[model samples]
Target: MCNEMTTSLKTEVLESPLEIVLKGSNTKFITAFKELLLHPVYSRPTLQFIESSVKLAPNRARVLAESEHGRLIFIQLLKQTESWYSGEDNFYLHLLNSIISQLLSADLGNLFLSTFSEPIVNEDERLSLLKIVDAAIDSLLERKSTTLDCQPLLEILFRDFTTASAQAIPFIRSADTSPEYSDSLLSQLTNIWNRLIVLLDIYQTILDNQPSLKPEILKDNIIEELVSLLGEAQKSLPRRSKLADLEKSASKSSSGNVSDHDDLDPKDFPLIKGKIIYLLGTLVQENKQVQDLVRQLQGLELVLTNCIIDLNNPFIRERSILCLRYLLANNPENQDFVAKMEAKETVSEDALHEAGYETELVNGKLALKKRT
Candidate 1:
């Protein structure tokens, strides 16, 4: 009798309306799922429910597999497990974390991974999701209530970084092939790159918490790719328009004083040789490679200092100077290198050279040759 009843229930559950609801498109399902997810009881038990549902409704699993709801549930469950790890003893924490890790590892986080890899997704949709994921990852990383036993989760994110960076080259090259598509693709690519940096920052936080989980492979290759991608994106920017927009934006805010060159169009931004140094200075000052590479890019430093010194805008000059100071200050090993570069360029020289003249030399000190 018990076996008969179990079979009956399974049949009924398989034919249920909820299972039917899961068959629809991902956007619709996520909309409905969000209500359930926000409710305390439903949200907390989501993982257990999902696991069981997948077993009973294999078809529903595929639909869920493609849905935002699925990724949301997975991320939420991982975070909740992190919370449980703090209060639970090592034995149970290890066991639970292991289970969560296995689930994410089985397919290398296929559900979350699939969302970005969707061939049908437009660049606009991709950009929107990237922003959403960035915020979600940031919130997850900031959760102090949770223990950081999430190596599997971090690995999944690392995999994402790898795939995104690989696809970027093709997208960038093809972007120009279609102007309308290129604009949207460029916007999407920028968002992806920005969010990856944000995600990398979170990944670094996890390593700080659980130092043993740092992947040497990622450190060696993935980081270099990330920096290279950022440099490439900066180069692709419409410099004149972007700088004009940046100046206008900067002026509205109280971050610093306005530049005399602030009113100057973006086309005038100095280009050195074949390299675009536009935001390389910003990246050097901001990225973790600060001590490692930014300090070493003293030619970049010279370029930035000269650009700022001649600019009419006080704000732009101050920002560039501040960045230079940071690159020099961050690494002890690079300090001597910075000092040597500074000493050599301390004297003002002729403006006849392409990079502009050092207009003033005071007591053997180099200064931007004032534009007469």
Candidate 2:
């Protein structure tokens, strides 16, 4: 009865009048609301109010985040919600995520960074933090993918951000774009890539502190998609090299849209492939299910074959080897399977040559390089 009365009070009496009222520098209201959060029944509606208020007036995110009572409310709510967090989709979790997402989309990411500057209480909190960071990465990936029309990434690409950009430029048949626009687009894409790395670094820090959560983090199925991304990046490379030819085709055509190839290029992203490899390595390390999943995709060979020196990947060869070690460790079937594979025939090099390639010496050994 009390809960019902409180809900009614929130909906009827407080709804309109309190909406504007709450946004003020009212310490008492924030403190009292924090108390309501301690009650299960009232908490949900209260948090909903918080999210809705932020949604209605985006700047209130800073208002809510920076204030002492407001900060305590969020922290208390975060702790309180753990009791009911069933998975990534629970209501409380989603509400919290919505609020955070709103804040981030508003260019208020500094708030989250500031939140992290304080000491984290424990692993659960840190894991929550990591998953949240991953979500932010996903948002960036989504924006980045908008360029690819690719589903984008989900593919492993090289370390140097430029390689990803180079791979992407041809999609528009680079020759067709104004040099200025391409440079501008290139700059924007590089900025997005840099932000992604910063978030990934945050992920690494939390994971380093609580390594066991790697598999838990993998439950999102990042590996399956990224391995798929690798295949797409590799297969697309040949096609990208041929993108210049599309200009020839376009010149002959009367109809033109965003340049079928211009939708997004795999190389538009920087250090994408290397990032993909590193993320997957974290996911599959010491996890049999993920290892088997990679093995099943013929991903084992796919990965091994690409383990070559590429400037875009910097230490790609090394990273790939380490990832392979993780894939094979303690899993004898994968071990024996990999052991039986011929090093010379790991992947069909014919595809690379067909795409166009040149041989060169690298660190004193001859290596295949895409023809510049």
Candidate 3:
């Protein structure tokens, strides 16, 4: 009798439609199946079933992403397997991972993007979606799937950064007056920054591995916008530092003792700053036009200043040095600018000319080179 019951149950599961199992009103079945889906022992078979179902009917899968009941299930599963990416054998996570892989493989980039971008009402739901998106991106990058178009995803990620920065800037500027509000803003900002870094790293990785794709990626103006944003953030750092010092002095005078206000560390902001510099380095590594653009925009100077400001952060320092190295690699004009800026003695135009190299405007920046 036990053997017969087990056989019947397996047959029932195989015959049931995935959509009904996922969004059905049978709470008992849903709850039991959810448990089974999350169980490490039973997850692989369950996930394989789901993957095959989705592959057979992608429209139904997309409808699931669009439906509230389906999204809730995804959110619940995502929360339950928060540590899934750490090599844990959670079935629900495996199922979701497999679904994402299938979607990318099928060249359903727009569907995935649209479904994931659904307007989630809850903050936790939104964050859960973000985490899911991040995992999907990692999987996509790992596969190096050539058929997948990353441009749309890149635009969405860049928009996320710009939107978050716009919201956080007001609070950042007025942080001295409203500490609590500023803390909240900074928390949001940090989350967005972390996501941006992940996305940018993925973007850089794709560009690095595929040389032919550079034209497609660079045509979007994403690099120029990123550089502009980086300059704006760097400009605000000193002002924020000065404001912090003033607030510290005021607190000390009023209390007649140095208040241990270690709540916010100015150093934390440099991690974002460093990531921006590193990304700039990645963008200009092989492109001479971009290198020349960075020179014209005084990006080199901004990077050099950051090297000093973020000296304690080895990763930042290393990236800054690499950026400088790449920027000056085949460009002598930028090299001469560095030399002139560093040297105490004034180097005349005549001296540059006498060195068998004359300054010529290349892409609107003076470059030193031998007369051709």
lDDT of 1 at 364: 67
lDDT of 3 by residue, 1-372 (tens): 333333443677568777876566655544555555566665556556767888787556754576555665555555554456556555556567667656655555455555555355333344445556666656666665445566555566565556655654553454344355366555665655545555556566656555466666667676666676567666654332345655765687688775333333442343556767877887787678888888788787777665442421335656776787677667766777765554533434443333234555667655555546
lDDT winner between candidates 1 and 2: 2
Predicted structure with the largest lDDT when compared to the true one: 3
Q: How would you encode candidate 1's per-residue C-alpha lDDT over 1-372 as one tens digit per residue?
A: 333333433354334544454544545344434444445544433344455555454344544445555555444434344345346445333433333333333433335445544453543343333434444334444666644345545555666566656656554444334334456555665555444444454454555455465443245454354446544434442233347665665675566665433454222212211122323333444344643654343343443444333232334344444444444443545444434444576422221122322234557654333234
Clashing pairs in 3: 333-367
Clash totals, every prediction = 14, 18, 1
TM-score of 3: 0.65
TM-score each candidate.
0.42, 0.41, 0.65
lDDT of 2: 0.55
- Order the candidates by TM-score, highest first: 3, 1, 2
User: Which rank order by lDDT, best down to worst?
Assistant: 3, 2, 1
In lDDT terms, how accurate is model 1?
A: 0.43
**Among all windows of ten consecutive residues in candidate 2, which has the lowest summed lDDT?**
148-157
Cα miss at 224, model 3 (Å)? 3.1
Candidate whose TM-score is highest: 3
Give me the runs in candidate 2 sitting further than 4 Å from their true place.
Answer: 1-22, 25-184, 237-268, 347-372
**Model 3 stretches with alpha carbons more than 4 Å out:** 1-14, 20-52, 55-60, 78-95, 121-127, 143-148, 168-187, 236-267, 308-313, 343-372
